[model samples]
Target: MAISIDRISKSYGEHKDVHALREISLSVHTGELFGLIGPDGAGKTTLFRILTTLVLPDRGSATVEGKDVRDDFRDIRTMVGYMPGRFSLYQDLSVEENLRFFATIFHTTIEENYELIKDIYVQIEPFKKRRAGDLSGGMKQKLALCCALIHRPKVLFLDEPTTGVDVVSRKEFWAMLQQLKKQGMTIFVSTPYMDEATLCDRIALIQKGSIMSVDTPENLLNKYQGDLWGIRTEHMYKALQDLNNFPSVTECYTFGAMHHAQVSGLQMPAELHNYLDRKYHKNIRVEKIKPTIEDCFMQLMQADEREPVPNE
Candidate 1:
């Protein structure tokens, strides 16, 4: 195993009332691309911080490559690369300078590890003389990733690596991760974007400081136990409101141009179509659609409850 976490928990303040992580247990196999999928305020970042040796867990334990996170933090820090959600590079330093600084701190030189970051580094090399603060969001993200990889860490922890970048940049970043995985690196990433969950080998859906589900993205989609439909009408908001008010509607939320709905009881799509058409004078289109990762995530979050992991 590359990563092993056992009932890890953390809280803030002297009162320790805020539970950032609640008995979280997980494992990441060597060379696997694992994802922690959740929105903001979930325990994804907290768990990443613990695994990266930056935060102490109040209870339980975690290890990276068999080294205890707390006891071997010094060693763990040297072997892991971390890219926080926010850009933390020196705004005053040039891109090249920032990369060099991180490499030197890891007791390695850029030339020694340049091969590890060559793909990502070359994109920013032209702007090496430019200040990191002056780069565009996408460029800055790639630069930050290069700096993180310069030391050739065994495991990479990326917390929302593409949160603010453009769509093209997001795609490029995932490609880089795929390349890294091919090179036998263990990557643990956390993202709020449900679309990215399907790209991972496995994902842990987290919410309110707890994990709601942990499995392959396809499995989650396959296990969704609700009738879902995509709806479009003259007034999107009004349509959603009216749909929610309907006794048969269990959950209704906006998704892109259409609103997705789950019915309270089993009902055929044709019956739903007729009911909507009768209720509203305007034509309402309803189509049965396959559930996406976002749909499954919304359903899991709506439950707001985590299933207990059996004791081993």
Candidate 2:
């Protein structure tokens, strides 16, 4: 296994002890592009920190490349490259200097690992003489990636690497990741973007410190259990409010330009059309639509909320 986490849990606070992770268990295989998909405050960062051996989990254990995170942190540090969610490169140093500094820390020279970062480094090479702080968001990200790969670590851990990057930059970053995966390097990345979930070989949908489901994006979308309809009207905000009052609508929420409502039974669509007609909605459209990963995530979260909690 590239990484193995068993029943890992973490909490913080002197008196209240807020739970960050709830007995999370997962495994990633060698050279697989595994993703931990979830929103903020869902314990993605905490889990990454544990796996990277930066912080200790309050309970349970984890391993990276067969080296225990607790017992062999030194070994794991040498074998895994990490790019945290935030940009952490030295703002004062030139781009090339930053890369060389990290290379020195790992006891390797950029010349020794040039091939590993050639494709990524080339785009930012012209700006190598510029201070790291002066580069654009995309350039900074590329530089950070070059620094991370300087030593050619076997496993790479990227914690939401594309969070603040521009759309084009995000696309470019993922392309670089794909190139790395093809080279037989293990990669475990986390992201909150539902669209990016489709790019992974397999994904684990995480929410509120729990694992809701784990499968390929296709499987997860296929597992969607209800007839979903995209409701469009002139007034989107009002339409969303009306959807909640819909008798057959089990779930309703806004989705981009339109609102999506999960209705029960086949007859619900016709009934919804008539119901909206009575409300005098213009250009009303109620059509069955495909569910995206975000829809699946909302379904899982709602189902979890509906589940009755056991008494202590």
CA error at residue 77 for candidate 2, angstroms = 0.4
Q: All candidates' TM-scores?
A: 0.94, 0.96
Residue 66, model 2: lDDT of 94
lDDT of 1: 0.89
C-alpha lDDT score of every prediction, in listed order: 0.89, 0.91
TM-score of 2: 0.96
- Judging by lDDT against the true structure, name the best candidate: 2
Model 2 over residues 175-274: C-alpha lDDT tens digits?
Answer: 9999999998888999999999999998999887788999999999999987899999997888888889977888999999889898776565778888
Off by over 4 Å in 1: 245-248, 264-267, 305-312
Candidate 1 lDDT by residue in tens digits, 1-312: 999999998988788988888888899999999999988998888898999888899999999988999999998999999999999999999999999999999999999988889999899899999999999999999988988888888999999999988899999999999999999999999999999999999999988777888999889999897788999888788788788878788789999999999875756777777766776637678898988888888888777644543332
Residue 130 lDDT in candidate 1: 99
After superposition, which runs of candidate 2 have C-alpha atoms over 4 Å from their true positions? 308-312
**Residue pairs with backbone overlap in model 2:** none
